[model samples]
Target: MLNIGVIGAGRMGLNHSRNLRQLDTIKLAGVYDILPEKATAYANEFGAKIYQSPEELINAKDIGLIIITSPTYCHIEALRIALDAHKPIFCEKPLCRTQEELDELIPLITNYDNFFALGFVRRYSPNFAKMKEVVDSGELGKLLCGEIRCLHGRYVRMHGDWFADYDKCGGVMLDMLAHHVDLQNHLIGEAESIYAQSFMLNQNEDELPFDYVSATARFKNGFISNIQCSWLRNAPSDTEMTICGDKASITFSDSKGLLLTKGGKTEKIPVDEAALNIHKIQGGMYAEEMAYIVDAVINGKKPLAGAKEAIDAMTFCFGMMTSAETGELVKF
Candidate 1:
């Protein structure tokens, strides 16, 4: 069995651990976390060892696979260890928390010789794939503009946790909006410039950071997208993206729906119908993403998305944050 060691025992790490445990071909070999108690709990529950450090986990002779599910800020160091270890590895998104970290990571990732994948699970959604197909096929004409809305239902839920700290999680921008930002950069085009505003950066010492952000981006291919994301105090969850072209437009949402409108008509494609049945064929996008990484690791194939794509997304995201900071258009 492929022995996999995971670094992190937080929310996302635990989520991935559950999924990893569900995979029959892999063994959940060990876990490492700064918090020994959390790591111990995971080790005890999952029948894995508590690796004292990332180096210990990565250096394990029997553990051939590494999965880095640590927080955004914690990713860089752990990833550097795994990348240099020459083991097939998977890392969760946003790449890193800051430009300094990005600068440190880029060369290593580019020069790395082994399998390296970044988790951008939205790519696995059939709706996303179909939308990409339609846009690439020119069925929507030349991609022109778009909007991405991600309302996270409510904001009061994570009051006293690490996620509430903007310095730690980057509020909603790095924590949540990165997914849609990557999607737009993927389906729309490479980001050329961005202007963004956020309530996150300015905070009193005693309070949590704000939970809203809006960013407008112009792509190299002349595609423009306005992205608004918020964790409203009390609102229903909603996330949708609409890309428009000269001839038509396409819209997709994970739980909402997939739609296409052209010449005053709208309907779901057969892919959407197939998407309705994806749960029967495989697990949801998360599981499918994990399975894809596992397959790539075992078979020596590249995942649907990898390091370069992640870096592109992270670069664009940083530009947005820069724009937010300066209150001016950031040219990339």
Candidate 2:
């Protein structure tokens, strides 16, 4: 069994821990968070030990993999500890707020002979994976254009002081757009230029300006894509994408599930057999992602979403933020 150590007990960290618990091929060796109670709670629930410090978890000989779900600011240091300990790592999105941080981690990444997978869970979702298959099989014909819209309500209770700070979370664009951009890059390829518009609609003394963000991207492959994300929408969390092609069109929705409308007819694609399992026990995308990471490590194969893919997505997001600030299109 692959010995795993989790380094946070926040929402994302808790989700990953639950998924890891379901897998028989892996064991949750320990968990560490700045809050001792949080770490201890997760450890006891999972029947795993709780380490007093991150360094202790990283240095443990039994931990074959380190999962970093800590706050965005602490990611670099957590990753550094894991690298120094010569352990494989699986990190959450927005690797770092700045390029320099990523650059510094590159040498360590190259030197460590272990697996590293970034969390871009959309790539592992069955609906999106099928869309990719259709595109690759030439069933979609020439990919002329694509559109992605991701909207969700911000958990007011969940947005604590640290997450509310723009400097730490990099605002809504970095924290949320990274997922859509990663999915776009995964399905439609790299973008050549980006034109974006963003704003802070709802603000209070207790919260930061991370309520809404939007961007339109022009891909190098002559396809155009748009993405919208929000933390203030009252709608029931809509996430849908449509890829328009010469022959047909493909679309899917997280709210209504997979959909295909083409040839003057619309049909709901049958949900994958794995979907029930994914939704029931594993909590949808998170479970799929955990399985993908385990397979990547054991098979010595690259994951559907990796560091380079994440970087491409983040580069576009950074450019979008720049565009929003300067009122100009940014070219990659």
The local distance difference test score of each candidate is 0.81, 0.78
Q: Candidate 2: where are CA atoms >4 Å away?
A: 106-112, 154-160, 200-210, 233-236, 275-282
lDDT tens digits, residue span 47-134, model 2: 7789988999999988888899998888998988887777778999888776577678766765557787788888777787787787
Lowest lDDT 10-residue stretch of candidate 2: 200-209
Candidate 1 vs. true structure, TM-score? 0.93
lDDT of 1 by residue, 1-332 (tens): 88989898887778777766777878988899899998998988899988888999999999988988887788888887888888888888878888888888888888789988888888888888888888889898888899999987666645556677677777777778878888887777678899999987335656544478898889898888889888766667789999998899999976657889888998866575555334343447787778767777888898877878888888888888778878999999
For every model shown, the clashing-pair count is: 0, 0
After superposing candidate 1, which stretches have Cα over 4 Å from the reference? 157-160, 205-209, 272-283
